[model samples]
Target chain A: MVSAAGGGRVLADQDVCVGAGQCARVAPGVFDQADDGLVVLLVRDVPAGEVDAVLDAVDRCPSGAVRLGAPAGGPY
Target chain B: MTTTDPGAATAQPGPQDDVPDFPVPRSCPFSPPQTYAGVRERDALTRVRVHGGKHAWLVARFEDVRTALAHPGASSDARNPAFPALGAGEQQVAAELRPFIRMDPPDHTQVRRMLVGEFTLRRVQALRPEIEAVCAEQVEHLLSRPQPADLVADYANRVSTTVICRLLGVPMEDLEFFRRVTSVSGSRTATAQEVGAALQELFGLLDRLIDLKAVTPGDDLVSRLVNGPLARGEITRTSLLSQIGITLNAGHETSRNAIPLAALDLLRHPDQLDLLRADPSLWPDAVDELLRHLSVADVITLRVATQDIALSVGTIPAGDAFIALLAGANHDPAVFDEPERLDVRRAQRHHVAFGHGVHQCVGQNLGRVELEIALRTLLERVPSLRLAVPESELPMRGASAIFGLDEVPVTW
Candidate 1:
């Protein structure tokens, strides 16, 4: 289910995260890493200004862990 | 999904004579192999002959290379008969030791998890002070040397070796020994026997260090692995040694090659160097730009397909070997504007120089920090640094696994 926040939904799956920290490095405003180096999402909804950076994080992430969720009311 | 036996597939057909040889040597140290420009221009997957006269699929476009790497069907397992080992001993080394970089999931994941915490962003950030100190010490050594000093040997190698040694908790008493080991193990021309001997000597020392760390652990990578993974039975003693060896080698080799090559790039383009000097904040971006430009570890990222994988350019059939040319992807004009130009403020940090996918360089954060500090210190301290000899006369390691200059003669 989408968070339905003010901005687009941002998803980070810790289970598959390889802890490469590309997300945290590429989009620090939206993502961080735990002490164990797993991805920890700081924001559920991506701010408009940070969308490009968040997209870059998705592209740069070695593991398919960080991604943008489908728009609200879109297919699950 | 049907899995074709790689051995059977290889036995069926030989590569066409038209297939170009893999690892076309770079005409200039600052650029990738001149061949990559033509390959990338095709915007498609191509076949190239590798070790043992075998053909492997080569992905050169930026997006296609990333796709090949990110695909789960791509396997790093060296045991696969179709796996490409650029050097004679490389396959044997990977098969015998089973380093996680040459492993697939579950196994790769298990070993990688135990080490990621050590190289996290925050953890590496904390090492900035120590790295700065190492660079400062090396710069002083450079100053003490006579004019026309060898920057590669005097400063770059020393700083990299010292930093990695401290991180691994290895004593600096055997720096020369470690250098000899990497020189042989990393050489593409080294015979299987020579590489085996070099690795044996290295493992012998690491074996002793692991034994010591088991009983007397410290706040270092070896100690942590000793206490955490080995004690937990997640990894065997032999595998642990292999992991540490790769980390130690990786921790230094890329940076050792990068530092001197990057300095030369700056020396070649004084305007870019001036841009960095004026706004010191641009140092980090400059380091990345240099890494992208130099692409020293161009041919190191080797892979083979486990299942048929489709790319925008073409489909890589299962049981076939493949390689993602990092140098090609980094220089793709479609991805980078004026790819040949070295712009410090390029704002492009997505280069695959550290590689892409799960097996990307684990020590990348540390590598980034180390390079940033080393180059910045060199430029900041030695403002008048310039090439002591014509760039044409500089010796390059043309056929080695890692690309770099044998010596960068410079004076201030």
Candidate 2:
């Protein structure tokens, strides 16, 4: 199942999930903790500018649990 | 555990008798006055006469030990002539396991660099929420159980083993198998046959995992290591296997012991538990203090002197073997104030529980995060957690390199 991180942006299991909680700990405004203490995405469509923090979160997942999906309007 | 000196009492004073005089910390088990009377009475670093070999110098001072650990003159290679066990057959085994933590600068640096990316602070912090959730779920289950549960078996060991398994990308179904292997490997008297069997099983498992990642790579560390720069021939398969084995061995056993040991310590001092619960911010510092008070790995990695070196304690001749006692150093009166007293709030920035220098534990940050999550979750979930048996009756010392309870039975 997928969840949102912030700005209503969707995060699938492979995207925005590094298994680390830099998002939950540092950017709690956009992330919430699941019962298992893992960060659950709370926003599904974040703006482009917010991508930096999300990427930082991605950089931190020890297991590399995060991936950024191409935006819909990107060059085919 | 006593041995008489053969040549010391009869012949003229030799190099063995001229042992250095490093002040042994009072925290050493050997330092207790009633435990080993004659040995404790001498200077901390006094040379002990051995029946089979010459007298060997002991480095008891913390700074001296750290220096020895980092010095080029001190070799992790067991082949040195002065190493106490040279007469025995410890060289071959030591040679095999000493690569990352035992070797001198250039070699140690190279091996460590290869694995350093896996343990970066950023990488470790990413596992926080997962680790926290695991701890919370485990503690919740423990809390729901009937009174008088085996905390060590039910909680600590499971939590540690699970985290380590996840980190290594070991199949969930295979965890029990690996846990069994790890438990046997860490036993005090594991026979050669048993160790051989365990290694075979572990290597078999790793081989399968490597193959699985090759075909269907996952986001786990193993897959990254296999398919990333390491896979392009930057690091050898044997080296990766060795690094994986070391990580698993260290990550599992150390955390397994630390969780229960810290639990027992808190249960023994309810006030500290209350203090921690009252203020969750104390969790990080509490973990450090727990590590110091219960310093899990009692003995630091062994170092053999490659050349003669003089220190504040005394002179250590070339090619001698010495053990750095992390437990002793943590409790050294000079380093810690009121060393024996357990203060969860103590500002303990430096503790040798995780050795020092190039060989210092790579996974220590992960370890600290694991401990913090486990302790905080336990406190929040099991408010009344207390020892089921008397403190004295609890088994505190294990037969392995790590010291912890055989089992911690507790009641809410």
Q: Per-residue lDDT for B1-412 in model 1, tens only?
A: 1122333333123533466777787788888888888777763466777777767877888888888898999999998888888887778778877888899998998888988888899999999999999999999999999998999889999999999989888877855566678888888777778888998998988999999998998989999989988998989998998899888887777788899999889989999998988899888889889999999988887888888878766678888888899999999998999999999999777899988888988788899999999998998999899999988888998767788888988999
Cα TM-score per model:
0.94, 0.73
- lDDT score, residue B373, model 1? 95
List ranges where model 1 is wrong by over 4 Å: A1-6, A71-76, B1-16
Residues B131-228 of candidate 2: C-alpha lDDT, one tens digit per residue: 98888878876877677888877788778888987887867564356557666655545654665567667777787888889889986778877897
Off by over 4 Å in 2: A1-76, B1-44, B48-56, B78-94, B97-99, B144-146, B191-193
Pairs clashing within candidate 1: none
* Model 2: chain A TM-score against the true structure: 0.55
In the range A1-76, model 2's lDDT, one tens digit per residue, is: 1124333343535232323343454445455545323446666555545655565444333333444554444321
TM-score of chain A of each: 0.83, 0.55
Q: lDDT of each prediction vs. the true structure?
A: 0.85, 0.61
Worst 10 residues of 1 chain B by lDDT: B1-10
- What is model 2's DockQ versus the real complex? 0.02
